[model samples]
Target: MAKSLLFIPDISGFTKFVQTTEVAHSQHVIAELLEVLIEANTEELQLAEVEGDALFFYREGELLSQEKLLAQIENMFTAFTGHLKLLEKNRICPCKACATAPKLELKIVAHCGDIEFLEVQGNRKPFGKQVIEAHRLLKNSVESDNYVLISKELSSDIELPIYYYSKVFRFKQGKDTYDQKEVEYIYSIIDSNKLNISEYSKAKEVVFDKPPGIVFDRNFAIPAESLLEYITNLSYRHLWVHGVDKFEYTENEVTRLGSEHICVINNKHLNFVAVKKKVKPGKYVYGEMTRSIPIADTLYQFYTISPISENSCSLKIELYWETKSILKKLLITLFAKKVLMKNTKTGLDLLFKLTEDSRSIPSSK
Candidate 1:
C-alpha cells in the first residue's frame, strides 16, 4: 500500500468560457490559457490529467508535505492570475477581470489525505475518500478572488496555516441543502523555478522516453486540408511499398518514393498500441484512415518509416484483402487507439524533400 497525496484544481464554470465566444474570437485567448496551463503543468507538476475544467496532479507518496502543497497551489494561482491579467489587458474577456467580473474568479482548493494503491487487472487503481472529499470541498466553496479553501480533515492531516471563514451557506443538492463551510489560504508570488513539472513540457524541445509506440503527427506543422487541392488532379499514387511486388505498381500508375513506414510505432506497455491517421483528399480509403490502419488487427506489419521533420507529412497507402482470414483480430483492435501518430515522416523521407518553403499546399487551378 503506497500512501498518497493529490492536488486537484477545478476552474469554476469552465464549460461557459469556451462556449461563450465565437471560434474566431476565442481562438487566441483559448490558445493563450492552454499555453499557460501546459507551461505550468510542464514546469511545475509531474502533470497528471487535464480534464475539461479540472486538473489532477500526483506527487510521490512520500513527498506529501504541507509546505509543498502550499507552494504548489500558490504557484498555480500566481500563474493562473497573471495569465488572467494578460487576457484582460488585451480585452480577451471582459468577464475575467477579477475586479469587475465576479463570476470569473477562480476557486482553488487543496488537501492531503491517506490512500492505498492497488493493482487491479494489471492496472494501477488508487482510491480513497481523500480525493472525493477534497473534490467536494472545492466544489462546495464559493468563488472569490484567489478564494482557496481546505477541509478540516485535510488541515488536520497536513501541517499548514488555515484562514478561518465560518460564514456557511447551503447549496442545492437534489432538493437537499448541505453545509458549504470553507477555510481559505493566503498565497504569495509563485517562483516558477521551484516547480517539479516545468521541464517536461517545453514547446520546442523534444524529449525521448523510448515511447510505448511510435507517434507521427506532423500535420500540426503541415495540414491535410491545405494539401488537398494540390493532389486532386495528380494521377500519381505514392506507394509506401514494403514486402510486395515492384513492377505491380509501374511508372504511370504511381510516383514512388522511399519513406519511413513507421509514422508512429509505439506500444502502451505492450498492451495498448495506437497509430495516428492523416486523411488526404482523393486518397483511397476502404475505412477511416484519419487515424486508423486498415486490416491491422491480427497481423503486425513491421513499419518502414521516412525521417520526420517539423513541416513534412506522409501518405496513407491502401491495405488489401490478400490475407482475409488472418486479419480478423486486427479489425477488432483498431478502434481503441488513444493517439493518432500518423505516418507522415515516412512519406517525407521517401517521396519529396520538405524544404522550408515546401510547407504550403498547391492551389487547385
Candidate 2:
C-alpha cells in the first residue's frame, strides 16, 4: 500500500493567550486565524478535525513533492502572520486580547506512513499508529514555537535534505522518544521577516478642517474598553440605539478599522464604514462614516472614550455633516440637527442604563 500524508498546523501559545487575556476576544482572534489558515490550503488536503487550537488534515495514498509540501507550509505561515500584522495595524479595541494578538505564532507538523481508516458517527477519519506518531511529533524538541517539522519518513519520501537552508527556512535534524520509541525529524525555525506576507488594508484616518457640528458628553461607570466594545460591537447596536429596524454585519468578525456594516432604518439602507481620527493619548476612539443619508453628502460620528478611573470612563460623541446644496444645509441646521441630537442623547441614556444593570451581575470570568 502507498504511504499517506498526515498534517497538523497548531497555533503556538494559544493556551497561554486564552488564559491570560479576555476570553471572548481571544476566542474571536483564534477563530479568525483558523479561518485564514483554512483558506490558505492550496493542496486540497482533507480536514479531519479541528483539535482545539490545531487542525488535523490528511492526504490519502499520496505524499506531496518536496516543492509542493514546502510551498503549502509557507503558504499557511504567510497567511497566518499576515493576519497577525493586519490585526496589529488595524486594531481598535484596547482589551488585552486584541492588543496582544500579534504575539501568537503557528507551527506545522508533517508525516507520512501507511494508513488505516475509522468511521465515527458517519465521518471517516484517518486511524492507526502512524496517526498517533504524527500527533506525537508535535511535542518534539523544535526549540521554537514558529516552525515546520517533517518526519524522517516524510523527508526520505520527498527527498528533502537533512540540512536544508533557505532565506525563510533553516532546517536541522532532531529526535525525541515517545513511549520509549525514538522518532526522528527535521525542523526549520521560520523567520516571519523572511516570508512575503500578503498586504492588507490599513486604517483610514480622516481629517476635518472644521469642528464637529454637534457634540454630546456623558460619563459611564464602566471601563473604557468595555464601553468601546458596547459601542463598536454591532450586536449591541439595536439594544441601545433606538429606531433601527435591523443591523447587518458579520456576526463572528471582530470590529476593526475599515470594517463595514449596514443600518436598516425605515426600509432605507445606511452603509457605514469604520474609520478613525487622531485622538489624545489615554483615549480610545471609534468612528464611522456614511454617505447614505439623504440630507447630507457625508456624515461622520465619532465615539471617544477617556478613562476617568479603573471602573469609570467619559464618552464624547461628535457628529459632523457636510453638503454642498444650500437647501440641504438649511434642513440640517433647522430639522436634522435637532433630531440627531435627540437620538444621540436617548442612545446614551439607554447605554448608561444597560451598563448600570450589568454591574449588578457578577462577572463570569
Candidate 3:
C-alpha cells in the first residue's frame, strides 16, 4: 500500500440525473468531460493510471518533504481546473440534465508516504498503502461543487502555495440508525491511490446498520465502582490511539445510568485530551478497538464520564468507518465468506476480551 493516495467519487446515476433535467444524455457529456480532465491531469501531476477514475502520482522518486509536495498537489489541481476551463461547459450544448442537476463535484483527499501492495499481478497494478484511510478521508469530505481539503498530515507537510484557496470542513455522513464521523473534504482528488477492486470487495462487506449509537442503554449490574471506572477509562484510553475521539452525552448510561451527559476529546495523535471546542455526537456511535482491531470488518467509538456520585455517567461517542457484505452475509457456504466470518468473530472476541480483566471489579462506576 502506498502511504498516500488520492480519491475521486463520481456520481453513479448520471442517467437518472439527466432524465429529470433539460439535458439529453448528460451522463455521456460528463463522462467525456472527465476523460478530457484526466488527460491533462496525468502529465501535469506526474501520475500513472491506477484504475478507474483514480491514479498514483508523485514527483519522481524523491521524497515529497512537505513544501515540495504541497506545491505539486496545488499545481495538479490548478492543471485540473485549467482542463475544465478549456472544456468550458459553455462550449457544449446545455442540455436539461446539465442545467438541472447540480454541477459535478469531486471530494479530494491527499496524503503521503503510506503505500503498500496487498496483491501483485502481471497486468494489474498494485494498491497503495493509504487506500483504506484515504478513502475513509474522502468519504468524510463535504461535497462542495469544487473544493479541496487536506489531511492534518498533508496540511503540516504542504504549504499549499497556490492562487487557489482550501478550507477545512468537518464532514459527517449517514444519520439516525447510521453512524457519522468527523472528516475533512476537498474538491481535488489528489491522494496517491485510486479506486482498487480489492478495496471495493473488502469495503462492500461493511455492515452499516445496527452500529453502536449516540445513545447507549447498556445494563450490567453488581460490578464494583473502581473496576467499572477501570474498564470504562481503559477503553476510553484505547479509542485515542486511532482517529475518531469526539464525544457528547446527556446522562449516565452504563449500569445505573446518569442524570446528564459528558463529552470527551482527543488530541491529533488520538491520545486522550480536553475538548476545548464543543460538538454534538451522532446517534449511532461505533465502539472502540480495545485489543487488536478486526481483520474482516471494523468500527470504533469513544465515551466520556463525569463521575457524579460514582454511580453512572453519560456517554457520548463518534462512529468510525464500517464494513458490511450482503453477499458475504448470504454466502455462508462459500469458503471466502466463511473465512471472513471467522475473522470477524475473532475480531469481536478480541475487542470484548479487553474488558475481561475489569469484570472482577464489579459494578463499573
Candidate 4:
C-alpha cells in the first residue's frame, strides 16, 4: 500500500440550475464547465473519472506540499469562475440556462491516505477506505456554497495555518458514526473580481445570424488532389454539374482565388465570384461567394477533404446563407432545404462518378 492524495471537485447547485433552465442549453453549459474544470489537471494530478458533475483526481507516491495543493485548488476555482463570467457576458440566447449561468459555483474536497492500485479489465482501479472517506467529506456541514474542504487527516501532514479557518463536523456513515475536523477556505473572501478577457475581446465583429442550412458528406475512392482539381477548375465543372451549359471566366483567367465565372444553367444566367478565405491544401477550402440570388449579400461555403488512406478521401461540403424576411426563412425551412439537399446530393454523386471513371481527363496545365 502507498500514500496518495484524493481530490473531488464538484459543482454546486447543479440540480436546481438544471431544473430551472432549458434542457439543451443547460446540458451544453454543464458539459462546457466540466470540460473547463478537467483542463486544469497538472502533471502531479491524475484524473480518475468524471462522476456526473464532479471530477475525481488523485496523485500517488510522495505527498504534495500544502502550498502546492492549495495553489492547485485556487487555480481550479479561478478557471471555473472565469469561464462562468465569460459565458454569462457572451451569451445571447434568452433561455434561463444562459441567463443564470453565472449562479453556478464550485467546491472541492481533498484527503490523503493509503490505497492499493489494481488493474481490472485494462483499467486502473484505486481501492481503499480513503477513497470512500473523500466522497463522504463532500456531504460535510460546510456552510459556504463555494469553498474548499480539506480533511484533518491530510491537513495533519501539511505545515499550514489551519486553526484560523477550520470547522469540526460529526456525521453517520453505514451504521457507524464518525467525527472529523475539516478546514474551509471560502472562495469569495480570497479574490472576488472577474478576470480580464483580453484574448476574446470582440467589440465590433458581426456574428452570423444562423448556422449552415445543409451539410453533405461523402467518401471518394480517389486522391484528394485529383478531386480538388475537378471541383475548382471550371473547365471540368460543366461535365459533372447538371444543366450547366457553360462556365466562362470574365477576366480570361481560370477558377481560383479572386476569380469570377459567368454560368448559364439551363439558359438562366448567374454570376459566381470567389473570395478565398482559408485554404489548407489537400485538407480543406473555405471561401465566400457572391451570386445573382438574394440569399444574403454573400454565401459562405467550405469543402473539407479528409484523407482516409493513400488512395481514398472523405469530402464534406457545408453551405451557409441567411434569409432576411420571415417569409424567406419559412420558405427555406419548408421547401428550399429539400430542394437544396437534393441538388447537393446529385452534384456529389456526379462528382463521385466522374472522379471514379478511369477515362476522366485531367485539367489542362
Candidate 5:
C-alpha cells in the first residue's frame, strides 16, 4: 500500500460548450486548452491519463505543499482564461462553440489515500477505492463553477492559508441511508479573484511636487498585461528584484490601494528599509526609502508602463530625490545620476528578459 496525493482538474460547462459549437473548431479549442493545463504540471506530479474533460494527476510520497499546488492551480486558470480571450477576439466563425467556449470554467478536487498501481500491457494505471473516491469527489455539491475542493482528510495533513474558508457538505450517496460520517465532506471554494496571481497598485496618475531627478525608459517584447503582472504581483516581483532581503506586507494584504510593505534590501552587507506607497492596479507603484538613524528621506522610485504593440510594451521609471538641500542636489547631479542610470538600466533589462521569457509559452493567439 502507498499513500499518495490524488487530484483532478475538471473543466465545467465543457459539454454545452462543445455540443452547440462548431465541432472542428471546438475540438481545436479543447485540445489547446488541455495542452495549456498539462503544461502546468510540475515535476512533483505524475500525470496518469486525460479523462474526457479533465486531467488525472497524482504525486506519490510525502504530502505535497499546499501553497505550490494552489499556485499551480491558479496559474492554470490564468492561462486558460487568457487563451479563451484570444479565441474570442480572433474568432471568424459565427458558430455557437467558438462564441460560447469562453464560458467554460474549471474546478479541482484533491484527496490523499492508499493507492496501488496496476500494470496492464506496460501502461501504468492507478486503482483502488481511494482512486474511486477522488473521481467521485468531482461530482460534488459545490455550487460555483470554478473552485478547488480538497478533502477534509487531506486538508488536515497540510495547513492552508488563513484566507481559505471551508464549508461542510452532506452528499447523499444514491439514496443509500447512512450515517453523517460517511457522507459529510468539508471543502473550500477557491476564490480565484482574491488570489493575487498578478496584481499592482496605483492611482490614475502619479503626481510629484516637481520633476524627477532621474528617468529611464525601454521597450520590452511582452504585452502590457504580462508586464503588469510581473510588476504588481509580489510573488513574481521577488524573483527578479535585485538585493531583496525580505518583505513585510500590511495586515491581510493583497496589493491594493493603501496597502503597504516594508521592503528590506541588502546593499553591500548593509540593510536599508524602503516603504511601498499605496498602489492602484494598472497605473503605477511608488516607494520611498524610510529614514533610519543614518539614512535620510531622500530617495524615491516610481514605475509606469504603457502598451506598444500587440506583443510589446514600454516601461518607464523615474527616481526622485529631495532637492531642498543645495549640497545634496549638487552631489546627486555630479555623481549619483550616473549610478542611478546604470542600476535602473540593468534592472529594466532584466525585467524585459523575464517578460519575454514569459511570453514564449504557447498561447491561443
Candidate 6:
C-alpha cells in the first residue's frame, strides 16, 4: 500500500491570545484564520478534524511531490499572513482582540507513513503510530513560531533535501526524543516579507462637506471600547434598536470596515455596509451606509464614542442623507427629518437603558 500523509497547520500563540484578550472577538479571529487556512488547501487533502486551534488533514493513498508539498505550505502561510494584514489594516474596533490580532503566527507539520483506519459511528479516520508521531513532532525544539517542519521519514520519501533553500524557505535539520525514541525533521522559519501575500479590499473613508441633518448625544457609564462594541456588534442590535423585524450578519465575523449586515423591516431588506470617517484622536467612530431607504437615495449614520473617564464615555449619533430628486429632498426636509430624529432618539434612550441594566452582568472574557 502507498504511504499516507499527515499534515497539521496550527495557529501559534492562540492560547495566549484567547486568554489575554476578549474571548468572543478572539474566537472570531481564530475562526476566520482557520477558515482561511482550510480554503488555501490546494492538494485535495481530506480534513480529518479541527483540533481546536489546528486542523488535522490526511491524504490516504499518496504524499505530494516535494515541489508540490512545499508550494502548498507556502500558499497556506501566505494566506494566513495576508488575512492578518487585512485585519490590521481594516479594523475599526478599539478592543485588544482586534488591535493585537496581527501578532498571531502559524506553524505547519508534515509527516508520511503507512496508516490504518478506524470507523467510529460511521466516521472513518486515520490511526496508528504514524499519527501519534506526527502530533508529537509538533512539540519539537524549534526556535520560532512561524515555520514548517517535515519529518525525516517523509522528506526522504519525497526526496526533499536536508538543506533546501528557497526564496521563502531555508531548511535546517532538527531532532527531539519522544517516548524514548528519536524523531528527526527539517524545519524552515518562514519570512513574511519573502512571501507574496495577496491584496484585499481596504476600508472606505468617506469625506463629507455638509454637517449632519440630525445629531444626538448621550453619556454612558461605560468605557469607550465597550460602548463601541455594543453598538457595532449586530447581535445586540435587536435589544436596543426597535422596529427591526430581524438583523442578519455573519455571526462569527468581527465587525470591520466593509463588513455588511441586513436589517429586515416590514419584509423589506435594508443592506448596510460598514464605513468610517475622520474623527478626533481620542474618539472612536463606527459608521454605516445604506441605499435602501426610500426617502433618500443614500443614508449614513455614525456613532462616535469619546472617553470621559476610565469608566464613562459619551456617544454622539449623526445622521446624513443625500438625494437628487427635489420631491424627496422636500419630503425629508419637511417630514422625514423629524421622523428620523424621533426614531433615533428613541433608540438611543433604549440603548442607554440596556447598558445600565446590563452593567452588573459579567461579560465574557
Q: Which candidate achieves the best TM-score against the true structure? A: 6
Candidate No. with top lDDT: 6
TM-score of 5: 0.48
Cα RMSD for predicted model 1: 18.1
User: Which lDDT tens digits does candidate 2 get at residues 1-365?
Assistant: 99999999999999999999888888889989999999999999999999989999999999999999999999999999999999999999877888899999999999999989999899999999999999989998778999999999999999999998888888899999999999999999999999998678997799999999999999988888788888888887887998999999977678999899999999999999999999999999999999999999999999999999988999999999989999999999899999999999999899888888886322211
Report, for every candidate in turn, its global Cα lDDT versus the true structure.
0.39, 0.91, 0.37, 0.66, 0.62, 0.93
Candidate 3 ranges beyond 4 A from true positions: 1-24, 42-94, 97-102, 118-121, 141-143, 158-365
- Tens digits of per-residue lDDT for model 1, 1-365: 34455666666545565576333223334444445555655335444556556666655464356655555555565566665543333221122221232234455555556765566676554457766665666544343433555554455567444432222211111111235533333322223233333222111211223332333322324543333223321221134222222212211111111111222224311121112222234332111112234434322221222223434444333321222444444543463232112333444343344322565643222
Candidate 6 structure quality by residue, lDDT tens digits, 221-294: 98887788788888888988989999999888999999999999999999999999999999999999999999
Instruction: Tell me the number of clashing residue pairs for each predicted model.
Output: 38, 0, 63, 0, 6, 1
Distance from true location, Cα of 53 in model 2, Å: 0.7
lDDT order, best first, reads: 6, 2, 4, 5, 1, 3
Reference-based TM-score, model 1: 0.39
Q: Kindly list the per-residue Cα lDDT of model 4 for residues 1-365, writing each as its tens digit.
A: 55798989998888888888665556667777888888876545888878878888888865778768766876787778887766665443334766787888888887888987778788786767778878877776556667677766676676544543312221111112246544333222223353322344322222355656789899988766556656765677777777678876632222334456777877777776654433354464534365565544445565667778767789988787765678777877788778767877888888888888853435421
Candidate 1 steric clashes: 38
Scored by Cα lDDT, where does model 1 land?
A: 0.39
lDDT, residue 318, model 2: 98
lDDT of the structure predicted as candidate 3: 0.37
Task: Point out where model 6 deviates above 4 Å.
Answer: 360-365
